[model samples]
Target: MDSFEQLIGKNINEVDLNESKTFFIALLEYDTKHCGKRYPSSKYKLADMDYYDLISFSQLFKKEAILIVWYNMDIITDLEIYYLSNDFDILFNDYYIIKKAIDNGLAHKLTEGDTKYLGASRLNEKVPQPHSDILANKREFVLKKKYLQKIIDEISFSCK
Candidate 1:
């Protein structure tokens, strides 16, 4: 699969792109609901995005059918895709990480013990560890509450 940038540029048609004001407006509503901020759009600055910005971008990218997989030390670390059936607006889909890894060639399932699936978005942490409360034993991927809350808090604080 192509990168988010490549996917959006290649997959979204010219007519859709031109008529996409509504799509972007819907995306804004989606972002506000999910990440508490409107996405910033500029072709030049994609490479410099921060975490929350990337979260915002991911929603729009997923809406355009882009699949984002963030890997950490060969674990199927983070997966982001929109649930289009529920709403025209975007929503996150959590996956059975172990199954996803095995299916996607990221890792093999272990018979016992916790399988660590670290977050690739550890912006400042010195070491990567379990970043979510969702049991690793369940083999599912979820963003950690504290990490997500911190981003939301920063968005709240900065906009104040």
Candidate 2:
């Protein structure tokens, strides 16, 4: 569906998970929009998993649409989780959203339901360096702020 770039813009620098220590895990469960035909991927399997593995596994299975994990980046990025899976080679994380629905609350509320693990991704690893995460977070916050201001200006002009 929507790439992070489309939703949040590419103004934010992609964090180097290999270096950052604060990590967030986004668990994903794809909704089946078609009739029959099970996907080549599993819904909720938690084994030693990591960001890169998510990237690789998605490429292999090609069934999962979005990788949904928790938004706790301060704790889960340094892990190479796929090492624990029976077939770690089949995981991937393309077009994933790092932010959580909790950030959206209300209409965009994060369901902390039991179905979370069922369609949720686990954030079990952390970025190796917290400093890296800090930089990424700052960049994202600033970019969003600027985007909001631009939208406000456009609306004001239209009303005038």
Candidate 3:
């Protein structure tokens, strides 16, 4: 199986979201028992090492389809798939600002509070940023947690 990073330039439809979700869930389950004490700081025993790559890849599509896997006490509980129409005028503007900031060497300064919907979030301190001239931590665009919660709330409300 190709790493999520390898799927960056591919069309969104070409990547099987269900397969990826299944793989991650299995990985988490296995890692929970065997990889004890490996990640002391993580609330969940397992962390997807490719999460930043996955989010970056998702941003390339106009219709960003994300699979949200819910967990309770480290056990998989539910899964919800949501699509963000990135081509909307406001979303496009936000994306453009984020891209411009990165291209302008401000990636290191980007914070989650910088945008209402989307944000450029730091991935790792040592990861090298390709677009910035200044040496900076690698960053990936992500939907703000608050914004994600709002979406989840709406979905939950509608389902009732």
Q: Please state every model's RMSD to the true fold in angstroms.
A: 18.3, 20.7, 10.8
TM per prediction: 0.18, 0.18, 0.51
Per residue, candidate 3 scores C-alpha lDDT tens digits across 123-153 of: 6654544455565665555555555555445
Query: What is the C-alpha lDDT profile of model 2 across 1-160, one tens digit per residue?
Result: 5553444444223322222232223232122225522121223332222222232333323332222221122222122222112222212211122222212222122122312112233333333222122211111111122222232233232221
**Clash counts for all predictions:** 1, 38, 0
Top TM-score hit = 3
Off by over 4 Å in 3: 1-59, 86-90, 126-133, 157-160
For the record, the alpha-carbon RMSD of candidate 3 to the native fold, in angstroms, is: 10.8
TM-score of structure candidate 2:
0.18
Candidate 1: clashing pairs of residues: 97-139
How good is model 1 by TM-score? Answer: 0.18
Least lDDT summed over 10 consecutive residues: which range in candidate 1?
A: 40-49
**Candidate 3 or 1, higher TM-score:** 3
Range of the 10 consecutive residues with the lowest summed lDDT in candidate 2? 134-143
Quick one: best lDDT, which candidate?
3
In candidate 2 the C-alpha lDDT for residue 11 amounts to 24
